[model samples]
Target chain A: MPGWLLTVWAAVVAMVVVFTFLTIMVMFSVWMERKVAGFIQHRVGPMRAGGFHGWAQSIADSIKLLFKEDLILIGADRKLFQIAPALVMATATAMFVVLPFAPGWQVADADLGVFLILALASVTTIGVIMAGWGSYNKWSVYGAMREAAQVASYEIPLALSLIPPILHYGTFSLATATEAQAGWGGMQWYVFSSAAPVAWLSFPLFFIAALAENKRAPFDLPEAESELVAGFHTEYTGIRFSFFFLEEYAAMFVMGAVGAALWFGGWNFPGIHLLEPGSALLQVLALFAFVAKAMALVFVMMWVRWTVPRLRIDQVMTLGYKYLTPLSMAVVLIAAFWEFGLHLIQD
Target chain B: MALPTPPREPARRHHYLGDILSTIHSTAKGMALTMRYLWRKPVTMDYPKEKPVIDQRYRGIHVLDQQLCIYCDLCAKACPVDCIEMDAVRHGKEIEWKAFTLDYQKCMFCELCVYPCPKDCFIQGTEYSMVSEDRNDFVHDLLTWKGLREEEPS
Candidate 1:
């Protein structure tokens, strides 16, 4: 193959890989969510779908959704309604372009990886708003407005919370940030780093903001089934409904992947440093370690979701604006001083 | 049931720090409770596959030992809803049993008829499944066998 053709070929393969990973992970998350929710409520969820705790439950659900009628509202802005889910899904997938899965396995390790991810995530809100407005329903518009308000307020704190790690790593790239945490057999993760208090404060701030961004519980006003009637995706049915669902879990994994790279030492594990660098075995092990870390964070998201009840819209806004934003700003200030001191001493 | 919201705190005492801290405290407690339940056995019974251990005194459907019934009309008369009906043909010392039906739709499983039975042979059994598509199917015949059986006492 020619050099340019090889580049194009590699890009195609990467897309296929990421898309496959996203679908499988979303399916698995759905199954995990049901099982976890059931376990908490003292009932067995989906016991006989594919046997052995109903492993194929989500797969069966997706297949059912696929054959369902693709409902399009008569009063909807047809263009925007049709495009909304695709836009949301695209942004979520785009975030994976910067996520360094293994040591050198990322599709595109952009210099502005962290910044680009944060930017793209907020764009998902625009797609949501489009869905709401385009649906031509009062309830859908309310859901959209609520989502806009929540995401706008939460994004500030979410972005601010990343400053400590970004400052410590001295780069905007997530790969660099992750590599910096590889010291001390992966014990030097940001939250436990030299700037302990700042990183510690920032982590919870980041996590809460991330939860709000993802529309997770205690902050899940948008998708409040009891009150909202399925929220922004109310008019969506069939495969289109599944797209929004897919976007949600995909976004969760992106958040988890970003968190792992930024704070939890991406692919670095104890005894990992002993392995030969750049070796195929090392890369494979690193990929597993990285994915395991990310998935653990995703599991925590599910655990918190099941544990907490949905917050009212006002309360979610209050927490995002009043609590998280101020706290993250303070963390950022301390982080700046800590990094400055480290820079002078090391130089 | 009406849900109890958190008590509204006065503005003087309601600082963000304290409120957030209390939220965290309560959330941790709730999470720990759920986590404990996660490891505990699920309380759900797999119906159709695993039958429940019904008590000996459970009032389900009536079971009549026809040979011991003695053709008394007291049990049928004692039924509050008048759901029980029976007839027997006399053949010298032996009795030939006919239909002994109880309309379960009206019977109520109250065991009212059992107390009036002189022979103590009319009683409720623990087989409680009563599902049917036809209305007449609910009018259950309590007798396991009709007419005089070989096992019946002469």
Candidate 2:
């Protein structure tokens, strides 16, 4: 195969694989979220959809959404309204291109992986704004505005918090970052690295900021159903609504992937060096490690979602600006000084 | 000749780091509680697959003991809404049971019918699942096999 053609083919294959994985993952996460919510509230949720505790509930929901009649309101900007969900879904899916699941498992493996992810994540804000503006509903516009402001402000802290790991690894490539953690038999995962305890601040900072970026609970002011009635997607129905749902769930996995790659050592496991990277067993184990770590983070996100009440919009902004942003900046400085001091000690 | 005023303290001294630490502690505590319950047995009983344990005094469906019931129309008369209908045919000395139906649409399950039955034939059984597509299915025949199976011995 020719060089460009091979690259194109690889890209196509990766896209297809990622899309399928994301679709299935979103479905599973939806079911898991319901079960988690049910358990938290002391109820058995979705019992009879497929069989044995509603295993097929999400699939059934997807099927229902597929067949549901599409409702476009008279006030809606038909073109932009139709495109908003697709835009959100596309941007969310595009983030996976730079996210490294394992050593050889990334889609694009871009040189500037971190920058690409941050950029793509922000693009979802545009989709959200379009949805709100296109809907022609006051509540939808309110939701969209909240989302725009939240994502825009939270992106700063989110980006700042992730930088420490990139600095530690001294590269923007997620694969390189993962590889960097492979030292010290994976004991040197960036979260625990550096003698400076303040480097640890980045973990929680990144998580909270990521949660806000993902528009998850506590920071979920955009879709505050009590206030805005389903937020920017209020006018959406049927398959279009499902697209937004897909994007949200898939974005969670993307957040988990980025977190795992930057801090938790991606697919690196202790004693993993004994087996060759080419070995099927090693690859499987590496993949398993990566997935388990990411899923654990996702579970924590779910846990936080249920534990905390939604913050008011002002509170959300206060958290992002007055707290997380400053805290994250301090953490970056601490990491830099720690690295500098460590080098001096060696000299 | 101005009056002396007390110095104002530094705006109540906000504990930024301390607040963050406490927030972490409380958030962890909340998450721990939810996590503990996540593994615990769910309070829900799968309704169709698993039946709930109903209390003995729960007033659900009505049961009638054909053998114990006499030709007394007392239960029918005692019904507040005349939902209970009963009839019997007499052949010489032995009485033949003809028809007995309870109109569940109006039956309040007050156990009023039970108190008036001299033979202690009327009872509120625990069979609460009374779903049906037919409107008249709510009118339960006390002489049917289902009704007889639900009969509790006095």
> Which candidate gets the maximum TM-score versus the true structure?
2
Leading candidate by lDDT: 1
lDDT of 2 by residue, A112-228 (tens): 998988898888878988998999899999998899778766899999988888777789999998998887776677776664275567889999998998889988787888888
Candidate 2 Cα outliers beyond 4 Å, as residue runs: A1-8, B1-13, B144-154
Residue pairs in collision within model 2: none
Query: Candidate 1 residues A90-163, lDDT tens each?
Result: 99888889999889889998999999999999998899999988988888888898898788789999999988
Error of 2 at A147 (Å): 1.2
TM-score of 1: 0.88
Superposed Cα deviation of residue A241, candidate 2 (Å): 1.2
Candidate 1 reaches a DockQ of 0.64
lDDT per residue (tens digit) for residues B1-154 in model 1: 9899989977776777899899889988988988888887899987787999999899988888876888888988988899999987878878778878999889888898999889999989999998999999998887767787668456
